[model samples]
Target: MKNNKPKYNSIIDAAVQVIAENGYHASQVSKIAKKAGVADGTIYLYFKNKEDILISLFQQKMGQFTEKIEHEIASKQNAKDKLLSMISMHFKQLAADHQLAIVTQLELRQSNKDLRLKINDVLKGYLAIIDDIVEEGQQDGTFRSDLDLRLVRQMIFGTLDETVTNWVMKEQKYDLMKQSKEVHELLVFGLSGNTHP
Candidate 1:
């Protein structure tokens, strides 16, 4: 009921911008409310507190993110192509939204342990997408059967996560999308120095 309200999305979007500009610890509910063009009390209607706002922001953004990745990869016939599509979409989405990139890549990491745990819970859906791609690859012989699914998932996610963090730290002066293909290549082939056959 509350989610369907236009202000809910406005609050979420404002939170992203406010959090991106002011670090999560420094961001306040009143500031978010002002940016959302609503009274401070209005934010309380949609969120329990600032922590709830952070979690809800991640949930809303990452939910749309995972859905977009799913839609992008749906038509691909093989795991390799599907993986590439996923990687490209991941980079593209972040690259397109500088505020979101900063909030996710830099700001979110500053939260406390409990908040981090909640954020990790929000990430499972995105991670599961990676797990499925890895499982599909292994089953189809596109990936090495000996690979550990958990490790592979971590490697893929860690690589992408760190790359965006670096881009944000560097003030995003470079073209992140351009590196998608090379990053995909590195993940699929690795540092073995052997070209893909």
Candidate 2:
């Protein structure tokens, strides 16, 4: 519906930048409208309120993020390679967009419980991708057969999430993309460096 309109995207992109720059609490709808080059009323035409905008922004950005990761991993033949591709793409996407990284890693976490729940709903798609990869690995004996699916999914997603959070907290001082290989190795091999028997 309204999503196909150019202004919708403009508003979402503007929300990301404004929220990232101002912090979600300090960011006003008027500021977002101005950033989008739209009248304040125009924002309401697309969103119910500021919370709606935040949820929409996350849904839109994460949709694209999941799609890109899917595309990147599709070419890999093995679960290990697909897993690495997923991690690499995750790092590359955030590293390429500092504003988005800030909004996702910091501002979004500061929202209320309801808003956080909605954001978590948006994340389910991304988590499903990780689950698929882990299941593939287990099926092919690339990962331990005894591994708990839910636990493994949480570990993989948590590792990637925390890594990005650390990078953002440190002001992104180093190369996030460069850590993809090591992170992949850590996830695949564990601290003991044991391979599947």
Candidate 3:
């Protein structure tokens, strides 16, 4: 962490806030710099443009998220616990970072289709984690082998995303982690092959 790096990071943090509070189109470099408590030129030094900020923010935050989930899940003994831990962690992390959550869930998608496709590349690591867990469960006889792994990946991501969106839309009145367990259980219910339980 260099001194200038903190300022740059502050700019990035401010970018997330500005984009979250104001829509992406509404956010400007001066606005972000103002929120960041730095001059306008400081922002341009760290970011090429507004679009760069959004993509960099996603890469930086989502990278850390993927790393943390990978580390957390590694300690768990079974595929089920690993999968469940991942879901709980994903929701809880975003719930903690409200500004980033708002930017990610609301503002980022408001960008054009091309930018979103690039963001999806950043998302692939997180999705791959889910796919790995699902595959592990299948190998261990805990999940359905016949289920399409790609479809299962979408379900987990989609359900978690929808749950978080609902939480955000409701003004975040309830515990997101609690909702995480429910989401995970619903996912397990669908993915697991135990019909009689």
Instruction: List residue ranges in candidate 1 displaced over 4 A.
Output: 191-194
lDDT of each: 0.91, 0.92, 0.85
TM-scores for the candidates: 0.96, 0.96, 0.93
lDDT of 3 by residue, 91-166 (tens): 9899998878888788777548889898999999999999999999999988989999888999889988888888
For candidate 2, what is the TM-score? Answer: 0.96
Best by lDDT: 2
Residue 142, model 1: Cα distance from true site in angstroms: 0.9
Model 1: colliding residue pairs: none
Residue 186 in candidate 1 has what lDDT? 92
Is candidate 1 or 2 superior in lDDT? 2
Q: Report per-prediction Cα RMSD to one decimal.
A: 1.6, 1.8, 2.1
Single out the weakest 10-residue window by summed lDDT for candidate 1.
188-197
Model 1 vs. true fold: TM = 0.96
Q: Write model 2 residue lDDT over 105-196, tens digit each, in one string.
A: 99889548899899999999999999899888878878877888888889999999999999999999999999998899989896223763
